[model samples]
Structure formats: structure tokens, C-alpha cells
Target: MERREFLAALPAAAVGLSLTETAKAQTEAEPFPGFQPPGVDRWERSDVEAGDRPVGASFGTRSEVFGRSGAAGTSHPLATLAGIDILRKGGSAVDAAIAINACLGFLEPTACGIGGDGYAMLWDPKAAKVVGISGSGRSPRSLTLEAVRSRLRNGFIPPYGALPVSVPGTVDMWWTLHGKYGKLKWAELFEPAIAYAEGGVPVPAVVAYYIRRGMTNFARPGMGIEELDNARATFAPGGETPGVGEIFRNPDLARTYRMIAEGGRDAFYEGDIARAIDAYFKRIGGWLSYADLAAHQSKWTQPYSTDYRGVRVHAIGENTQGLATLQMLNILEHFDLKGAGFQSPLSIHLQAEAKRLAYEDRARYYADPDLVDVPADWLVSKAYAAQRAKLIRPDRINDKIRPGDAPSRGDTTYFSVADRDGMMVSMIQSNFRGMGSGLVADGLGFMFQDRGQLFTTVDGHPNIYAPGKRPFQTIIPGFATKGDQPWLSFGVMGGDMQPQGQAQIIINRTDYGLDAQAAGDSPRWHHEGSSQAMGEDDPTLGPRGLLRLETGVPDRTAAALAAMGWKIGESDGGFGRYQCVERRMDGNERVYGASSEMRADGLALAY
Candidate 1:
């Protein structure tokens, strides 16, 4: 029988719960072969048997999305739709991004939330240049390096706990963006997310997968976790996370959003929400206090750039690891990558060698410029990158790479939007280490970010644990321009893999001549276990770390990399997820092409 016919024939009284409610109960349903089961419809990879693409089409899993007036791309289908809705309502790119972010916080809270930090790179049409915004939050006012040391385990701050909690800057980020460029009302941005939170949304397969992992991690004992009851109550009702296609609701988050909508930035930073967070942390012996929240302020930073094939590629400056991309690009700019061939072992080795070298500087010099005398200008200098690039070899890994002179600077969610007026926004937000610090405020439904954990306890280090200092961050937004037009607003999501992925995307499109979709669809690599950004001084990790390759890479390339004295491993889906919206000129009219990550539930659309 059809679903409608079955529903009409069987009354609600026959079963204790409706189909959706049964799915939400987090139990396996009875098996009935050839029958459609509730909560089982998932977004799986398309079957290869569907037939290959026509000649000259994208080698990507899907065709590039095109739009003339505007475009939106995000990690989730719902959030992208929310962005499109806002744009249809006469909203600016910033407004659309704000709406998408708010919705993403509820739809994919394991990756981001209002209880986290964010950074953005904007392609402002009026300014005719890209701008950067640092929405990073600071450590607690009461915190001292010694007090933080007292809570350390194995010389490192616990990744998920009260000790790692920081003041969340995401609300302030929204307000700052709105005040500068928003077209719709301030309250309008929260409508879609608030409604979804109250009425509930069916959990997607990918989101459910992450929620399960994050919730289990929180439930693990001896992880320094405290006051987790609130988190558990909010995310995993009845001691379990919602299943795929199960309707999940968060009324507390809805109430919180409503409060922020009415009270503006003050509500989250200094009002009732702040008081609740302060009281909860105090009860749990945490560092964050009402004062920390009240004093928190987001900054407007400069977006640094370097030329690659004559295109201006921008990255967020100081206190973030964004400059690594510019430095990497600068180093590779001296090479002939088109001749080297895409995914060649030579190309991979060069990029990986440059990455560890750039990361060496990032670990040593990148810090809050306000606190440390970072070598800001020299870090992104072509001369400096060129000097460092000389150490890399074509046939071998540069295991001896280390920091030269410099200044210094996880799961994350990234989205990009473009409006009809020619403005583009590239924004990235995160609750660090998946679901943040694993502690929720008394009445609020969101978890605070664990960004404070990224700080090392070593005294005098550029990124050491200190009171009222913003810790090092992983999330970054990317933007690029061609001549005078807004070219690209994009970002790649992953801890430490962001810059590497951004570089790959740029090379893929600009040099390899791939379309928007094909650029993201191409196989990638990640280099991990390098000298630490969040580790103690003189970490014993050897220079030669494992280089993980995506499945699409050939066995011959893997063999070749191993022959070069490098350890090769298979990817565990950490390569990175990319999203982009590209703008081009088709004669007199403006044209757009957008791409979303095939590895994720995201989609790109234009109108």
C-alpha cells in the first residue's frame, strides 16, 4: 500500500508511536523485505552503474551549479536552502550567510554553534577588495598560566572540559556582520533556525553519524568532563542520539535564539545567557565567568594575500593559521606545477614539504599579535617563502624542516554566499573538537567552545595559556579576486587540513583547469603528526609524519611516495570538505558557478 493509504488504514492507536517517533526512539525497526522502512532513507554515494558523464563534462560526481543573480553553498542541504530563502527576501550576502550559519548551528551543531568562535573573509563589492573579521573569543579573566597549569594532564590542557572553555564569539560575529552589511532586520536571521529548533528537523545520516560519535566521546569517563548532564539532556534525549530521518527538536536552543534575536549581542555576551553560563561554570569550578563574557569583543583584521597565476588569493591574518596558505602558495608559485602534472608524486612531495615547513613557522610564530611580537610581514613574504622553499627536494621529504624567522599565528563548518549586488561572504565557524567543551550552561542548550585547549602551557611561548588572550584557532575562510571582480568565496573544513585543502582547490581550478565541482571532487592528501601547534616545547615527534592519501590516488603514486622514505597511509575521511562559489563575467553580464563537498551532505544552488 502507498504511505498515505497505509496511514489511513492503520490508526495512531494501533502503534504506541508514529513512524517518525518510532525512528526517533533510536531502535531498529522490524524487518520487512521489499518494504520501505522509516528512518532508513539516507544520502549515499551515487551508484557507478548510473552511467558515466558525456565528453567534456565535469569529472566530478555532479555538474557545477550555475546562477546569474546569486548563489549559496553549505555543508548541509537545509542550511543552503535557508541561505537561498534569505536572499529571495532581499537580503545581502552577509544576511544570507548569517541565516545559513544560524541554521547550521542547529542542523549540524557537532561542527558549529553560537557557543563557538568564527572567522570570515568577505569580498565586499563597495570596497572592491576582500576584508577579514576575527570573531575569536578570549580566555577567562580569572585564568592565569599557573592556574591553567594546575588543570593540565600530561603537560597538555584537556581537550574537552571546563578548563578548555572560552567565551563564545559567534553571536558578536553575527552582530558585527549585520551592523556593517546586513540588509534585512537583525532578528530575521534567526527565524529559520529558531523555527527548526522548536518544530524539530529530521536528522540527516551524516549529522546523525557525527552526533553519535560526539555524544559517545562526551559520555566517556576520565576525559576531564564535568557538568555533562546538561549537554546530554540537550543533545541526546533518553540517553541516545536521534537516528537518521528521526525528527529531533531543541526547544532550549530555540528559546536562546529568540532571546538573542530580541536582546541583540548584549543578550549573549552580558545578559541572562551570560549569567546562566557564568553560574553553571562557577558551580562546576570552571574558568569562564560573567566578566569574561561581558568583556569579549570581536576584531576586524586584515586579510593577507599572495599572487598565484596573477589571481589575488586572500587569507585571514594574525592569530590564525591562514597565512600558511599564502606562504605555501608563494613557495609553489616559483614552481611549474602544470608541467609536473596533477597528483604526481613530485607535486605531492613539494606541497607536503612546504606544508610542514610553513606549519613549523605557524607553530613557533603565529600568535595573537597583541600579545606577541610576531614576524607578521616576513611570514607571508615571497622572499621568506622562497628561502624556505629552497629546503624542499623534488624526490625526498624535508624531514629536517624547522621554523625560520617569523611572527606567528576541527571539525569545522564552512559556507559561502553571493548576492545579486556582487557581494560575496566566506565564513567558517566551529565548536572546537566536536561538540565543543562538552559542558552546557544551566538553561541554555549549546556547548561552549574548547578553543582554550589549543594553547600550550609552556611559558613565554607565543601561544601560551594566558588570561584574556585568544588561543590559536583552526577555522579560516578563503577569498580570491581576478582583476576587479569578486572571484571566489570558499573554505575547506578540517583541523589543520584547511590551508592544505585551500591550496589544492586553488591549484586544481587555476592550474589543472578543473571546473568548480571537479576541483573539490579531486583526490587530496593530508600530512599529520608534525611538530605541534598545541603541543609542549620540544615535542619528540620526528619530522617524517604519515602522509594520508585519499582512495582516488593510484597505487603507483603511493608506492612512489613510500620509495621516497615517506610513510603512506589510507585516508579515514580527513582529507577535507570544500565549498565554493565562483563569479565570472559572461560578456556584459555576471555569471556564477558553485560547488559543494561530495563527501558531505552539502549542496550548491543558484537562482
Candidate 2:
């Protein structure tokens, strides 16, 4: 009998079973001998094979919430719920964040996964200080500038394929954070994600959209199905992407998580998983090795901060663009953004000019700290910002700005978590570009990050490609403190939009007195690349500068920016998705405030 005929013949009640139960029942029945379900693990059946479907359609508008116990916010409602569940189980904020991020790896694969890198900022209430975790992986020892240039077409590595793959650092970071601040057993944190992976989650609307987009790209001519077999097998089984309400499962990922839970980090870094990854890289002509995986370690670094209007802004130092956000905020501190009015021409221009100056320095100086001297303290110094602020003209845009002498400074999904005890966690993770390098380890069910592509091929450049050197990263986690107490934990997920979003959120909250939710919901603008010099076309920026403003920005604001020589374009989706949790004093008691982005299919939940 045909598959459709078999399905049609089933009883309505059988059909009504949640997708997970239906699959298990069919497998148990063994209707056809030797038949195996798509994406099922051969070794063992998942323990939790069925559960209730996710509730409600995303309304795209979430209210700012206040909670006395705890608050959690993320780019996905399910992930947020998972974090809250952890907190309810008497886990710390770090434990909740780890659980939340693990779920995101399974649910939002387009933005992040176990194969990517991560950075986090955690406020330890006992220690009374914010600690930074750098989970970024280094380049393969065999991958060198000469080797990369020999394969490059125009001094730029292709965005996809094995060439751009980097060693994954997320798993290491997870274990490191958990070992220090986690209140629950490491295995316990993986339970929620494992259950979701096995029970089959309903595809979220945003995830379905990105999955379809990826399928379309992979189906194009010359991009054979065999090249991304693992991806197709996991995300597009049956040669079709799942729709928003359809159930999707990855038993392989569930198994992988279980192994890591049992064997700790060694299962992923030095055991069968690592060996399989090494073999896969060899087959694909990639440079990663088992030694690199075994040698990879996560670092606990002191977070760097800058004072902006009495609020101390903390960001991960080195190899990340977090410092750039601080610099931008410093420059904007010299101006009265609130008095200029939200989205006003003067405000927009000043923000854009500051970003341009910050990015110029970022492109020049930000890189792996272990490999180069990153002048982090000098970059975030108020005096240096004052010097860069002088380059911004109130009357017109300045296109001649260059990297300052002070030196610098780095896409991705972000989620923020805060527990009732006032401990906060701000975390960001990514694969550098959408869907990452598109290289899934054979049967591992995850994509390797394309972060290495960000390294410059130029000799002597701060971000120059080198063996065992980490590339400059775009994903950053933002944290803010007031009077040495945890005040805010937030992050924005998008390539260069991260720092830009960070600066805007701070300005909106501090200068305009907007609540966390309102601050994230406000319309925003992004300045893409630098302007061309006269008739010369910048190889990096093409011909002209492009300014993208969301629809919320008034037409007059765009016109005013355009009149000042910026090529303005309207953007449908605003700058990026933002998630934030702020701790505020409600009289004598401290309360938590949480906010989720309006442009995303997520919610801010409190309990």
C-alpha cells in the first residue's frame, strides 16, 4: 500500500495522537518489516516520545512583565519556558541560561546550535561581580593565511562549505559555567531539551520561514542534495521543510544530548563524537583535527565596563564586538538623545556617525586577545570617545571617518535570564551567518560555525587569519549595573546589528526613561558598511553607504537623513530581535522586569 493510502486507512483517533506518539505506535506495530522512521536513532528509543503541543500562536507583541520570583526572556517562547522551569526547580540563573540555550540549539537551528560558539556575562550575587565567559574556539592549527588565500576567489572566503568551519566552543562554555555557578547537576539541565527533542516540537513560525529559505538555497542548481545530506535529513526530512504547526523531531540530536549528559564534555570533545567529527572533516577536506577539539578550553575573564549616565555597561572583552557597543554609547553620552526626540534626524545621524566611527576601529583592532594586543581599556575610555565624538557633525553626516589611534575592540541568537536572588545571565551564541557554514558533522545533527570567515587576509592586520587564532566575532552579550548591583541583562541577535542594538536599547532606557519592553519595541536604524571615497569604489563596501530604517521611523526622519547625504532605505523587520531582564527597586523591595522583541516569535515570562 502507498504511504498516503496507509495514512488514510488509519483510525481518526490514531491520527489525532501527537506526532511523537503516532511515530512510536507505528514503530511498535511494525506494520512493515525492516521499516525505520525518518531521523530515528537506531541504538535506542527516546524515553519521552510524546507530549502536549505548544500552546498559542505568537502575537508578535509581548508586554513588559514584573515578577517577584524570577523572569526569563528569549527569542523563543518554549526556550523561555524551559528557563523558568529550571528556576522553579531551584536552579541558579546560570543553570537556567544553560537549559534555555540548549533548547534553542534544537528549536532555532538557523541562529545557533551545539556546533557554534557562545559568550556569556553572569552576575554572581555571592561574589558581587559580573564574570565573563569566552566560549569562542580557535582556528585549526593547519589553517593559515597562505592556505586560505590560495583558495579564496576575491580575498574573501565563501560563506558556506567546509572551508569556513571553525572548532565549536559552546559545549565547553556550557560545562565551564555550569561547574562554577550552576545549582543543579549538569545532567539535569539537559532534561528539558532532551524531552523536547524526542517528543517532537511544533515548528515555530520564524523557524519555519528560515528553514524554507535554507531549503530553497540548497535546492538551487549546483548545490546538490548530497552536499548537505545531514542537514536535509534533520531539517527537511521527506524532502520538504516542516510548516509552522507541523511537528518536527531530531532523535539524533536527542541522543547526542544524552551522551553529553552522561559523559560530560568529553563525550563531545574527545569521545566518539569528536572522532566522528574528525573523520567527517577529513572526508570534506577541512582542516579541523581531534587535537584541536581536545585542546579547546573556555576561559573565565573579567568583564570590561564603561560608565554611561551612572549605569555601568559590562561586555565580554577581546575577540568580540562588545567593546564597540560601549564606545558607541560613550560617544552618544556627549549628546542629549532624549531632548533630540526619538527617531529625530539629529538623533539618528549622531547614532549612525558614532557607529561608523566605532566600526572603523572595530574592523582594524578587534581580534583574539591571545594572538594580539587588544587595547580594550583605552577603547572604552571616555576620553577616547570624546575624541571620536568630535568627528560627528550636527549639521551633516561625516563620511571621511577612519580608525582612531586608541585601537579597539565582534549573529546570532540571544537570551537573558534572571533569578529571584538577583543573579542575572546575559548570553549570546551563533554560527556567524544564517545556518552557519552549512557543514553538518556526519550523523551528528549540527552545523559547524563559519566564524573563521571574519578574519582578514591582510598581513599584519589585528584580525589577520592565523593558526590557532580565533576570528573576530559579531555576537555579544550586554549587561548593565547600577551602584554595584545587577540592573539589566540583555542581548540583540543579528550580525553587525548586535552592538548597534545594544547602544539603542541603553539610550532608549536611560535617556528616554522607557521600560525594558518599550525600549526593545521602539523603531530603530542600522548603518551598513562605510561610504565610498569620491569616485573610488571600496572593495569592502561596494559603491555607497546604505542606511536601513524600520517603518516606525517617520518619513521625515528618513528624508532628513537622506538630505544629509545618506542613502536611506526602508527595512521591514527593524534592526534585530532583543531580549532583556531588568532588576529594579520597587520602593524597598527589588523586582524583576522582562521584555521580548516585537519582531520575533517569542514572549517574556515571569513567575
lDDT of each: 0.85, 0.83
Tens-place lDDT digits, model 1, residues 80-104: 9999999999999999999999999
lDDT of 2 by residue, 1-607 (tens): 6978878876655677888888777777664344556544232322322233343212224457889889999988999999999999999999999999999989888789988999999888989999899999988988877888887745676567777678899999999999888899999999999999899989877888887876677667754223687878988989898888899998888889999999999999999899999999888788988998999999888989999999999988769888889999999999988889877999989898898888777887788889789888888899999999998899887867888875334347899999978789999998777787777887888778888878777777878788888888888999999999989999988888888999998998898777788788778898777531211113565323678997667789889988988888658453888999999898988888899987777888988
In model 1, what is the error at residue 63, expressed in angstroms?
1.2
Q: Pick by TM-score: which candidate is best?
A: 1
| Highest-scoring model, lDDT | 1
TM-score for model 2?
0.87
The regions of model 2 sitting more than 4 angstroms off are 1-62, 221-226, 407-410, 531-544, 572-574
Compute each candidate's TM-score over C-alphas: 0.91, 0.87
Model 2: colliding residue pairs? 321-410, 366-409, 410-473, 410-474
Single out the weakest 10-residue window by summed lDDT for candidate 2: 530-539
Model 2 misses residue 477 by how many Å? 0.2
Task: Quote the lDDT for 467 in model 1.
Answer: 90
Worst ten-residue run, lDDT, model 1?
A: 42-51
